[model samples]
Target: MREAYHKELESISEALVEMANLVGSAMGRATGALLDTDLRLAESVIDTEGQVEELQRNLEEQAIAVLARQQPVATDLRVVVTSLRMSADLERCGVLAQHVAKLARRRHPQHAVPRDLRRTILEMGQLAQRLMAQAAEVLITQDVDAALQLERDDDRMDELHRMIFQHLMDERWHHGVETAVDVTLVGRYYERFADHAVSIARRVVYLVTGEHADDYLPDTPVIH
Candidate 1:
């Protein structure tokens, strides 16, 4: 029975990795669809979101079952609880990818990203893919350093997000309100996707160290 219980825990870990892989692929395809205005690819991403959702639902059920049956403690308990949180983050990442795809579909042949902002959007997409891939590695290896690196990656995404807004707010902006709105939404989707990846990485940090990342921060020096 002890061996079987360990296997179940291992299975949960495997499921989380699988979830990350699926969402990472979705984000890549969604980015392609957005850049090229490929409705078919966009639709494919939107459709695959159901798979991510299903995986999350099934993983949550499995985790809950382990908790109820095995009553895991210490590291074992952290594994189960953290897995649930990671699944939620992964699911949200999938949804954000779907949102990107939907925007592409809604815009259709016109392409959602304008010519001037195309490079920035492309970089954001690539950054998102890299972050998710790293997040998956962190989940599988529980490498705390790699997990901390993801936070830096997220900062890059945040910078790109700000760049998008700056362009939209430029005095010479001429993309029209509709294009501005689309760019705003797409930029936000990519930013949120990276945020989710960072959240998952933070959870992994907590899982491995038994302390939240915030716990390690130096206390603000008290002013006299």
Candidate 2:
């Protein structure tokens, strides 16, 4: 029975890794859509969000089954709960990416964002996608150290988010409030996506160490 339970747990882990890969792709596509104003890509992101949610639901049900049937011990219990929370965060990250895509649709044909600002957003998107990929890798390898590295790497995303805001604020001062709101919201979606990725990393820490840890500093000026 214990052996059977262990096999089930391993299956759950594999499922989670699969779900993470899909979520990471969603984030990547959303970012690409935002940068290139690719309406087709944006639509694809929006369409695939349902799939991400479905994967989350399946993971949650599997976790509940493990808890109910096997009654995992402390460590295994932690892994189950952490995975549940991480999947939820990852789902939200996908939603945030879709939100960015929605925004991309709104400003179609009229590129309100400056080319330099678009480049910055592209960098921010890359960082978010990288973090998502790292989170998945940590889960796959069970590498606590890689998870810690991902946690630390979130700081750079925060920095890029800040830069976006500073630029938007500067725009407000110079270009007036015309494009300020759009810029602010775009910066916010990227920052929040990073935040969710960080949350996944922290959950990874919890999964391996049975302790919760955060990667970013508080008091950073958020775009929202």
Each model's RMSD to truth, in Å? 3.7, 4.8
Per-residue lDDT of 1-224 in model 2, one digit per residue for the tens? Answer: 98999988888888777877787787788778777778888888888868878888999999999999999888889888888888888788778887888877777755646676887878888888888888778888877667667767877877888887777656355655766777787778778877777777777766666655643323223432
Q: What does candidate 2 score on TM?
A: 0.87
Q: For this target, which candidate reaches the highest lDDT against the unseen true structure?
A: 1
Q: TM-score of every model?
A: 0.94, 0.87
Candidate 1 per-residue C-alpha lDDT over 1-224 given as tens digits, one digit per residue, 9 for 90 to 100 = 99999999999999999999999999999999999999999999988858988999999999999999999998899889889989999999999999999999998989778999999999999999999999999988999878877886688899999999999999999989999999999999999999899999888888887778677323323222
- Model 2 pairs in collision: none
> How many clashing pairs per prediction, in order?
0, 0
Error of 2 at 101 (Å): 1.0
Question: What lDDT does each candidate get?
Answer: 0.90, 0.77
| Candidate 2 positional error at 133, Å | 0.3
Off by over 4 Å in 2: 171-178, 214-224
Q: Which pairs clash (backbone N, Cα, C closer than 3 Å) in model 1?
A: none
